[model samples]
Target: MATTLAQARSVLADAGAFGFPVDVSRRSDPVVGTRDSSRPEPFATLPRESAAIAGEVLAGELRSSTKSDGSGEYEAMQLLRRPVARATAAATLGAIDDDARNEVADAALDWVDALGPVIAAPAPPYRWSRARRQEDAARKSLEGRIEALGDPTPARTATMLAAGTQVPIAAGAWLLVALAERPELQERLAAGEVEPIWVVWEVLRLTPPTWATARVARRSLDLAGVRIPEGGVVVVSPLLLGRLPNLVPGGDGNPHQQLARLEVERWRDPHVRPGAWLPFGLGASACPGRSVGLAQLVALTKWATSASLHLAATPSTDQTRGIFPRPARIAVVRVEGGNT
Candidate 1:
């Protein structure tokens, strides 16, 4: 069934009437949490102090993936992982040092990897099972590193880092893929005529990292003309709703085409708001790290546009662990006129 912007917003707004779609019974699971308390705070607004730090860190990370001579091929998604991970760690755990940031970033990825089989498993594993053991080890390693920070509480830090690190990686990768395929946009960007921030929003609109979020019905009710029994699953797809003409600015062309392809200029209109499509999310469960995520993406976009991007192969989506470009390899033929 097609979901509209109004319906998606309505479903997400009532968090009380709807609950998380993930299994929340397992207290030991590193990924899923049952309570609102587990959701960290103050990250929704990225402080100016941290924004500069994050932007610099993100730019450096992007620069590092280039060849020693300053030009080379890179796995776009793979290249983005570390920088995004480290940037998110820096943004979420401000007290940590560079070395600790590296440590916790690596650990956050491990925890995310270990969570894959855990979620795909027929059921939650035994506490001592291999998946559980790997997940636990990664979680502990991350916790130990972040616990040294002493603020935001170690528990909040861990959750924030995990959620904050993973999604941005996927989003950044998608952004790069879009840029690589559209050379004219890349040229415009290199010429300093484009707003990198708008590129970030457009990318999110076409391919949001968290494409869909779920809610469980608390009690039987009819919603958006569908009847839901108690404990029923009510799904809201940002990807689907994003394609709706009403939410995205059509200008004079077919609005659905705007949904299918990246329109970097669609958001340039002053009257159009940046997030009508529900990329970060809505209501109490909406991601708090959104501001920080956007900052990191903007920084990445700035770095990417200045480089000559040549795709090794057309990148495809790997739905295995959320959406990231499958085999995300790309060649930076040159870094702004530098020879490889």
Candidate 2:
């Protein structure tokens, strides 16, 4: 049978009991252990690394734009759409042949052209500064709100945002997009066969883009009979759990449907079980920008749906995990007169 939300919470709590204590303050002394060493270390330096990579990528693309050749221009356009490739381009450019380097440069250039205007227009002074002033402004605003409420706890803003906005916005946006794209789902929604909120829950539950998350074990634990030593690290994923036969109907219950129900419940009443439905992570380590990020996502979805957008014939699907699961390319085009 499908695990009820209560049952899932129990399982998660049991796992957490066997897991390591989370240090929200970031002041805890680092501890070393065998199982912990096997997992990917937290990329504490990611913010800096991302800034540097973005800078190099933009510079490389801009340089490519100077070329007069049509092929170079086309390559630049391609690169402009795939900003993530810039880092790889920068790393491999020197070792590759002229043709390969040019290709990389062109793609980088294209990506820069497409996305640069958006970045540059927002804060001209911060151009190339890498300070991310807009995000800082939002964070400060959120912090002030927390302070006014007399809650100075670390990550309080992040927690509020995750529960109040991020999850809801992501859930809504993803579902709306799915409905607009999938005719059967759209018909179902139109016919009032499924709750709109449930649609969002189902979409996220079934297609969570994030593959896994790592956690440290506070003490020794057993997983499916495998003994894990204390201070060991464990990676947990709903993707794997959802696929377990015993968790689904016919075997047990449909994990996807159960997760969907859980999401719907959480969205409707976050306080009903705080931190249990943590696609954004639980407790102190939850993402800080989740609110604004979800807002952006929701806005984009609203625009797409209103414009009657359709995905490109060959949209890209390569996704990588960050703070959350996200699509690599969610291309869509407005269908003329399709908006109702």
Candidate 3:
């Protein structure tokens, strides 16, 4: 009566080839958990298993290099790539079988190793709180000098970008959409009427801007006249689906309004159903590190917004992947009047 997990994956892959969007509607299939389902509950699980493997590779390589003191050319590259590698590893681990997980991990490590140095590191060394505070403080001081000079500084830009600040920019955009309908929420935030921490948690619980994701069918799947065959990956972009007109009550055409309605339906009250508004994903192949990712995003957003940091405007689009859709060039400016 239902399509097998393997069948669905095959369908997704095939559909991807033909440029068809995979339909991720609940009517089509159930979201399955990871292969190692016995480990723990989704939210409580530590990404340690995945993180350790990645860290080993990353740390090992850095240790072996002549610049192992954390100041060599490799340092900047590691700073930029490590998070991406960790996120990718976590996502891959969540999506694959146990056997494939190790392989993917190894492949990712090798890929990172091969990438050499980061031409443009994403964020500054100081932005990563994990780095020594002195380093961050010194970098912050230097940044002030560079800003005063009014000259473009690649290193500073790279460091800021790499420091995880960009995540909040994306989060803020999403929050703006959420606040559009509930102006009161925005007012409360501005007036300090609501606890900032609570707001962060609420935003985390809210589904991402995009909802469903699709992959192509590699082969024909013959169900009771459903017939989703090979080479037909019809993915539902959650952004579009979450805002789909029919899903909204009273038929408002605005995507933001639909998003607000969905949020209310899913999060505003208790006793909500489990599978509505799957922004991260649903089924066995959902993004595993979603909790950590959301945590990082919320933390980043709270810090940026509270400090009155303004981000440079940039274009962001979903390239059909359902996991992360963020803006490309999000520049930051401190309203407090210092280069951070």
Clashes of each: 0, 16, 44
What TM-score against the true fold does each predicted structure earn? 0.89, 0.44, 0.40
Candidate 1 lDDT tens digits, 1-340? 3288777777777765666655322443232323564332343454667767777788887677566765667787678778888888887777667897898889888887777777667778888899889888878877887776665476666777788887888888888788888888988887878889879888888787777777766667788788877667777877877787778876357665556877778887888888887887887667777778888888888887667777778777877556778877776766546332
Lowest summed lDDT window (length 10), candidate 2: 68-77
The TM-score between candidate 3 and the true structure equals 0.40
Q: After superposition, how far is residue 268 of candidate 1 from its true place, in Å?
A: 1.5
* Tens-place lDDT digits, model 2, residues 1-340: 1123343333234433333333222224333344443322221212334334434543444334333221111221132333223333333222344454344434333332333333334333343343344334444544454344444552443333323232333343344445545655444444555445444434545554443455655557665555667766566555454444344222225655454432332334433322233444433344433333333333223333323233333323333211232331234333344232
lDDT of each: 0.75, 0.38, 0.37
TM-score of 1: 0.89
Residue runs of model 3 more than 4 Å from their true location after superposition: 1-212, 216-219, 222-225, 245-275, 314-340
Identify the superior model by TM-score, candidate 2 or candidate 3.
2
Pick by TM-score: which candidate is best?
1
* Model 2 stretches astray by more than 4 angstroms: 1-11, 20-141, 149-154, 162-173, 209-211, 250-309, 313-340
Query: By the TM-score metric, which is better: model 1 or model 2?
Result: 1
Per-residue alpha-carbon lDDT of model 3 for 191-247, expressed as tens digits?
Answer: 565544444434433445333344544345553357765544445444443443343
TM-score of 2: 0.44
Candidate 1 stretches with Cα past 4 Å from truth are: 23-48, 251-253, 336-340
